[model samples]
Target: MAVLSEEQSMLRDAARSWVQEKSPVTAFRKMRDSGVDVGYDADAWNEMAEMGWAGVIIPEEYGGSNFGYLSMGLILEETGRTLTASPLLASGLAAASALVLGGSDEQKSEWLPKIADGSVVATLAIDEGPHHRPEKVEARFEGGKITGRKTFVLEGMAANLLVVSAKGPDGIGLYLVRADDGGVKRQRLQLADSRGAANIELNGAAAEPLSGGFELVEKVLDRARAGVAAEMLGAATQAFETTLDYLKTRVQFGQVIGSFQALQHRAAKMFTDLELSRSAVEAALTAIDNDAPDVAELASLAKAKMGDTFHLVSNEMVQMHGGIGMTDAHDAGFYLKRARAAEAAFGNQAYHRDRYARLQGY
Candidate 1:
């Protein structure tokens, strides 16, 4: 486990209290069932912003606390515990990082403050295909216009601004495109996790150039991956705990299932993996904060490890609960769905495993 500063500890505790009391799994179920176009409770997002969570990484001059990556990760972990649905990750962390790292002064002045205060929702519109291949961007930025389609855009339906990756005159570059542009069209996707996503088609929409080339896209993506790994750690931990509770209570052959050696071994394995995953996740987040040269390597390590653990724990959770876990009424199904969706997001275990080895020059 990572050591926490006084403020980070307070922030985590407060987030825990609020999520437990106000935004539990039950609340998530409600939001999902409502079929909200935005895919999150607008009121809950406002409350999170009001608490300064949306600005955890933004500079103080831009109306944010400038806490850094691990600080934001702590809050994300808390939200993952309850399956909270919000644009905080997409807009607050990912898009904000792009601007902070590569945006021009004018661009930062326009978008950073709005993102910090939740006045606007902005997200990265990269990955033109099903998988997260940032290097395969086919989107074109020419003549001050963007043209191409981006698929599986996080918070796409709700974003006011898109930090888009496209091939510019100087190789692949990041551009800012307005969501409401004349040539933009979006189709909402009803994913199993019920999270907000869209397939966006941009046909010569007016675009504003940001800064940096593909390297900026990579730096922003590394931050996003680390943030996702942190969330996976929380979900995997919670799933294991939930399964453990079931094992302790569910009886078979006149004995508690947890007393069975086979089940006990599984539980031990999950506990060990969860602890290890936490270490990798925190290390990745810390590397980002320090701007460590090995951030990509650590980010891939964390994401791949956490993805494997979450996959194992979520599956075990369903199996341990028997028929009840398979039902829609039970919360186990929620964790399973979220685990699969999250595993695919940013990158899956397979994807990161390859990336990690490549980073090490293996």
Candidate 2:
């Protein structure tokens, strides 16, 4: 088990209480029904910035807390419990990770402060295909401009700055591109979880190169996978807890279903999976914080284990709840939808499983 310091515990507790009180699952329903252009609530995001969560992983020089990735993961876990949609993971962690690892001194000096203050929204646009493939980048950058289409960009529609990957003359390179520049187009995608995503087309859009290329991109992805795995851990655990409550109180054949041996066994399985996922996510977060040599493999392990567990727990959530679980009126279905979308983010269980094996030289 991972040990938490007093501050970390306090941070986790405060985030849990705030998310449950201010932005629960019902908040997501309201956002969806409102037909808003943005998928998340802006004021809620500002509240998070006030909490200093947006700068959790950044250095203090840039107005950040320099608390590290584990702290950020804890906050994300709390938000994920209630399915709170925000760019915390996309911009706060992922984009910031890329900039911290690859950005030049000037680059970091320019953008990190804005990211720390929640003044700018950013995203990493890497994959050009249906899935996560850092090495398969075909988008071209030449003459201080990028030209090509990037798909499945997280928070792409809302991000003002994009850390993009393309095949440069030297090799695959990372560049910062402005979304508002000429020849830039964004088409928002409607995802299962209703979290914002988009396909971005850059035609001669102005760009500035970041220091690291493919190597840094891969590292940034590992960090992203770990963060998402933490979120999945929280969501799966919440679903399991809610379902367990139902099983205890819900009656069948003139008795509480908790007394039935079959239902008991299913609940036991969910509990086991949820606990295992928690362990895996915790280990991954620690690995990142320590800059462990095997962080990449650990990240892949966390992503695969947590993603599969969430899928199982969510499916079982609906099955155990009966027909009402399938309806939009029930919150159980939303958990499943979020689980599917999260499982597909960064990489699915199958993709991460393969990556893990390769990392282990299997």
**Segments of candidate 1 deviating more than 4 angstroms:** none
Q: Put down candidate 1 lDDT per residue, 1-362, tens digits, no spaces.
A: 78999999999999999999999999999999999988999999999999999999999999999999999999999899889999998999999999999998888998899999999999999989889898898899989999999999999999999999999999998999999999899999998889999999999999998788999999999999999888878778888888998899999999999999998999999999999999999999999999899999999999999999999999999999999999999998989998999999888889999999998998
Candidate 2, 1-362: lDDT as tens digits:
57898889999999999999999999989987776665888888888888888899999988898888889899999999999998899889999999998888898999988988898988889888998877888789999999999998999988989999998878998899988998789998998898889999999999998877788888899999999998888898899999989988998899998889998898888888878888889888999999999998889999999988999999999999998898999999899999999999998999998988998889
Clashing pairs in 2: none
> Could you tell me every candidate's TM-score relative to the true structure?
0.99, 0.98
CA lDDT for candidate 1: 0.92
Lowest-lDDT window of 10 residues in candidate 2? Answer: 31-40
What does the lDDT read for residue 305 in candidate 2? 93
Q: Cα deviation of 144 in candidate 1 (Å)?
A: 0.4
What are the lDDT figures for the candidates, one per model? 0.92, 0.90
For residue 269, give model 2's deviation from the true position in Å: 1.2
**Model 1 steric clash pairs:** none
